[model samples]
Target: MGSTKHDGDVIILTGASSGIGEVTAWELAKRGYRLVLAARRADDLGQLAGAITQRGGLALPVPTDICVEAQLERLVQMTLDHFGRIDVLINNAGVAKAQDAATPTNPHIDMILGTNLIAPMRLTRAVLSHMIPRRSGHIVNVGSVASYISAPGQAVYNASKHGMRAWNDTLRREMKPLGIKVSLVSPGFIRTPMTETVRGMPMVGPETVARIIAKVITHPQREVITPMAYKFLIALTTAFPGPSDAVMSAWRVWKW
Candidate 1:
C-alpha cells in the first residue's frame, strides 16, 4: 500500500523542477496521484507538468518560492481550488548544504535559514488550517541524515533539518488524534542534481529515494530511511559514540 494507495489522491509537491522532488513527483504520478507541482522556476515546473501529462498523468505547475509565505499560500490555495482538497503535502523544498566562517563570503545566512527552515514550517501551518477540519491528511517533510548526524561546513542545513525533525515529532503527537499523519523522511545519499554538488561520496538515484518517500506517505510511517544501509550506520553511531565521533571528526565532517 505504497504508491498505489495514492490512487485518486490529490498531492502537492515542492522543488518539483529538479532533483529528488522532480523524481518523486513522477513516481507518485506513475502510481496515479493527481499532483500539484510547485517551484521557483516556472518554466521548469511547466515543462515538468507537461512531461507528466505526456506520460498520461494528472498534474499542475505552480510557480512558487518557498521562502515567501504568499507564494506558499497560493500553492495551498490553488491545490484546494483545483482538487478541492489536498491529501498529501510534500515539504521537499529545503536546502541540503551551506557555509560557515571558514570562508569570507559565507553566502547569506538569512537566505539559508529562510529557505531551509522558515518556509517549510509556514507551509505546514497553512496546510493544517485546511487539513484539521478534514481530519485526514499527510505531511512528509523530506529531511536528510544530516538532521541527526550533522557536521561542519553545513551548519544551517543541519539546523533546519533538526528543526524539521523536532517539529514533525511534536506535530505527530498533536495531529495523530485528528487523523493527520506526520512523517519525516531522512534519506542518506540520493543521486539527484544536488548529489553532484556533494564532495567525495557515493550516491543513490533520485528515483530510489522517491520510491521510499511514496511508500512512507501511503503507509503512514513515523520515519522513512532510504538505501537501507544508512539505518545500520545510524544505529552504529548511536551505539558507539566515541568511535563514531572520531571517524566523522577525522573526515572533517563535524557532527552538529
Candidate 2:
C-alpha cells in the first residue's frame, strides 16, 4: 500500500519565518502538508505554526540557527520523533551581501559560508539515514543564479552557492539508484528580507519561488533556473565565456 496520504504529510522547512520559506510553508499547508518550521526566531515560527494549525493544518515549530551542527542534528531528531519520517527537507536558509569593492572586507565571510553552505550540508547528512533506508526522499537546496555567473563584489556568495549546486548535482547521482531525489532551485533575486536590505536589483516575489518549489518537490529534476530566460542565458554563456563575464560584470555596477 502507498504511504498514508493527507493534507498533513510532514515537511521540514528551514528559514520558515520569512521570505521563500514562509510562503512555501503556507503553500504546503494549503495542499495539506504538515510542517516542521525552523528559524532563529521562536515567536515568528510559533506564529506561523499556530496559523497553520488554526487553518486546519499541522505544524511543529523548532526555532533553529542553521549555522550550528548540533542544532541541525537536534532538528532532524525532533522531526523524526514527531512524524516518524521526514517527507522532505528544504535547505532554504542563507545570507548574501556584496562586500564593498574598494575595502574588500570579509570579516563575516565564515558566517556567510557556514550558514549558507555548511549548515545545509550538515542538515542533509543528518537526515540521510532514514531516507536511504526507506529508499525515498526529496532534498531541495535553494541556490542562486550567482552560482552560474561570477560577479566582482559577490564572489563569496557565488562560491557558496556554486558549491551547493555542485553538491546537488553529485548527490542526485549518488542517491538515484536508492530512490532518493535531490534538486537545486537557483533564483535570481527574490523580494525578501534577505534581499530587501540591499538596493536596486531585479526581484521576484517570495510566492513566485514558493509555487515553483512546491511543484519541484513532487516531480524531481537536477536543477531549475527559473523564468525560462535563465535556461537560454546559461546556454548562451557556455558558448561565449567572455560575453557572459561581461554580462555578469554589468549586473554588478549597482550591486557593488
Q: List TM-scores for all candidates, in order.
A: 0.91, 0.90
Range of the 10 consecutive residues with the lowest summed lDDT in candidate 1 = 97-106
| Model 1 segments more than 4 A misplaced | 1-5, 101-107, 253-256
Instruction: Give per-residue CA lDDT, model 1, range 6-65, as digits (tens).
Output: 588998898889999998998999989999999999999999899999888999999998
Model 2, residue pairs in steric clash = 7-32, 7-33, 8-32
| Per-candidate local distance difference test | 0.83, 0.82
- Root-mean-square deviation of every model: 2.9, 3.1
Please, what are the lDDT tens digits per residue for candidate 2 over residues 117-177?
Answer: 8988899988888799989888899998878766677767778898998888888899999
